[model samples]
Target: MAKVIIYPTTSLILADLVDRMGHKALVAPEAVRDRVTNPEIKSPPLNITPEEPKKGLKYAAVDVPSGIRGRMALIGPLIEEADAGIILDDPGVLTGCAGCNRTNELVRLLIKTKGIPVLDLKYPRDDTEARGFVARIKAFLEGLK
Candidate 1:
């Protein structure tokens, strides 16, 4: 099974779709779950502790833009662990959070750099589109397997 990274990482639709297609979703919500709710662990970018601010800077320490380092801290690991991806680019969703654009871009870039098979798609607006979306995703996952 491929470990696919689903962007907007909190997207339940993509997560469910990935699972239904028989793949592992390295979603942000699942990855950061313990860190966010568990008091012992400090979440970065999302819920940074005093010490985590400087952490994970190396991921974005290069010629990339600033402010993204913190966001990368959370995403970098998941991307590193992923073998494939499915991105739902829905402009109607306001393009996700503010910094997410940069983070998402970086994730896609990294996925490309890693030479993984990534399926990029627009969020379905209707039942037909939704069915097409599922078919496309299933095809992608099957190809990986």
Candidate 2:
């Protein structure tokens, strides 16, 4: 299993798509920003959406007071100190957002997402002709188990 935060939309889909795609998604904080954004950082490999979350996928949101002090200041460390990270070719599809727009945040998050024991899946966004892209994630996740 890999450790990382995903966006609300992405987080929700990730809930099910996670291990299903093949990775032990260590249930982390879903605290809107931390929960989702944090994982997004490390797991650059996940698929993210800017408009709305994918259906059937479920995720939690973290509720930390605005200002760096109340939030990441605490959780950020935990993520940094994590054992491993997950990254895919894409962050997923975009749907919607209440606070930050998916496109805007995704840009920053994409660059920010990185760490050790990375289960980075350098899969292509295209290729209906390929299956390894999906399998790579699954294989990585399975390794954890």
Q: TM-scores, in order shown? A: 0.79, 0.41
Deviation in Å, model 1, residue 2 alpha carbon = 1.9
Candidate 1, poorest ten consecutive residues by summed lDDT: 91-100
For model 2, how does the per-residue alpha-carbon lDDT over 8-72 read when each residue is reduced to its tens digit?
Answer: 32344444556575544432234344435555555343222321232101111233223222223
The residue-by-residue lDDT of candidate 1 on 27-105, one tens digit each, is 7766557577766654543565544435656567656555566667667788889998877766445434324577777
In candidate 2, residue 96 scores what lDDT? 21
Worst 10 residues of 2 by lDDT: 51-60
lDDT, model 1, position 14? 78
**Each candidate: how many clashes?**
0, 35
Q: What's the CA error at residue 59 for candidate 2, in Å?
A: 24
